[model samples]
Target: MSRRCELTGKAVLTGNLVSHSNRKTRRRFLPNLVNVTLTSDALQRSVKLRVSANALKSVDHRGGLDAFLIKASVDDLSPKAAELKRAVQKATASTAAAA
Candidate 1:
């Protein structure tokens, strides 16, 4: 797998490392990705994802995985996260329709 965050689409960023002598070297600024199991209240299941630290914090701030996915924009999310967002939307819609 690539060094990418599944939720936020965060990946390795290329930049220059400058020294005191004015010399520059190529360097990578990688996202802080971690494997986590998040439970979705809408789906009533646990899902595993490789997400960046910021994304995890956002999920918490949004209340849960389903809430985060529902509020997140598709352009800023990875393919997997987009799919999960769709699933969450569908589940919530079904629940609402049934109620």
Candidate 2:
């Protein structure tokens, strides 16, 4: 699997590591990614995802996985996350319609 966040789509960034002697070396800045299982109220299940620490915090800040997925933009999300967002939206819409 690639070194990328499944939620925010954060990936390795290329940069230069400069030394005190003004020497610059090519380096990669990787996102702080972790494997986590987040529970979705809409799905009534837990989903495992590789996400950055910042993305994880944003998910929590948004209240839950379903809310975060709904609020996040499709352009910023990974393919899997975009799919999950659609599923969550569908589930919530159906539930709302039933109610």
Candidate 3:
């Protein structure tokens, strides 16, 4: 499988590295991904996901891995849920700008 973050949709990026001599070299920037198991009701089993460190951090910071599931209800959102959401959004925007 590719090194893609299923949670945040982050993937490896390709670009060029410019040196002081004005020479450019090809380079790859891989996302920080980890293989994690998440519970799934449809399959009645745990599903593995390749998620970025930032995405995982957002989930854990809000609650835990369970919150990363798409089907998870928002009723149980933590008191700091909004903060976490904003943080994730900001991070994503910053990444996009950098790219």
Candidate 4:
């Protein structure tokens, strides 16, 4: 349970918080991570993921979990999300081969 978005790989960023007196303090900028259940059309199942709000919007823009995973880079996805992407790819490939 780290503060990271499973889909987009968004993580806590370290930065300086400058005060009114021109003093700087260390601070963290965290992504807006939300627990969401997204449906995969290829797998025909719903998967739970902790994703950033921006990532969620991208998922919608890209067309759903399957499409998003298919288009996403493997380096950006978490282990679980990468696994799901593989599964979805396999499932879709199998269907395409059959047809």
Clashes of each: 0, 0, 0, 0
- RMSD of each candidate relative to the true structure: 1.0, 0.8, 13.8, 0.6
Clashing pairs in 3: none
In Å, residue 59's CA in model 2 sits off its true spot by 0.4
Report the Cα lDDT for residue 88, model 4.
97
lDDT of 4 by residue, 1-99 (tens): 899999999999999999999999999998999999999889888999999999999999998899999999999999999999999999999999999
> Per-residue alpha-carbon lDDT of model 3 for 23-91, expressed as tens digits?
999999999878777553323445566677787777677565534543333343332333444444565
Each model's TM-score?
0.93, 0.96, 0.54, 0.97
Stretch of 10 with least lDDT, candidate 2? 71-80
Looking at model 4, report the run of 10 residues with the lowest lDDT sum: 39-48
Q: Which candidate's TM-score is highest?
A: 4
Runs off by more than 4 Å, candidate 1:
none
How high is the lDDT of residue 59 in model 1?
90
- Which candidate ranks first by lDDT, i.e. highest? 4
Query: Global lDDT for candidate 4?
Result: 0.95
Sort by TM-score, top down from the best: 4, 2, 1, 3
Better of 2 and 3 by TM-score: 2
What TM-score does prediction 4 earn?
Answer: 0.97
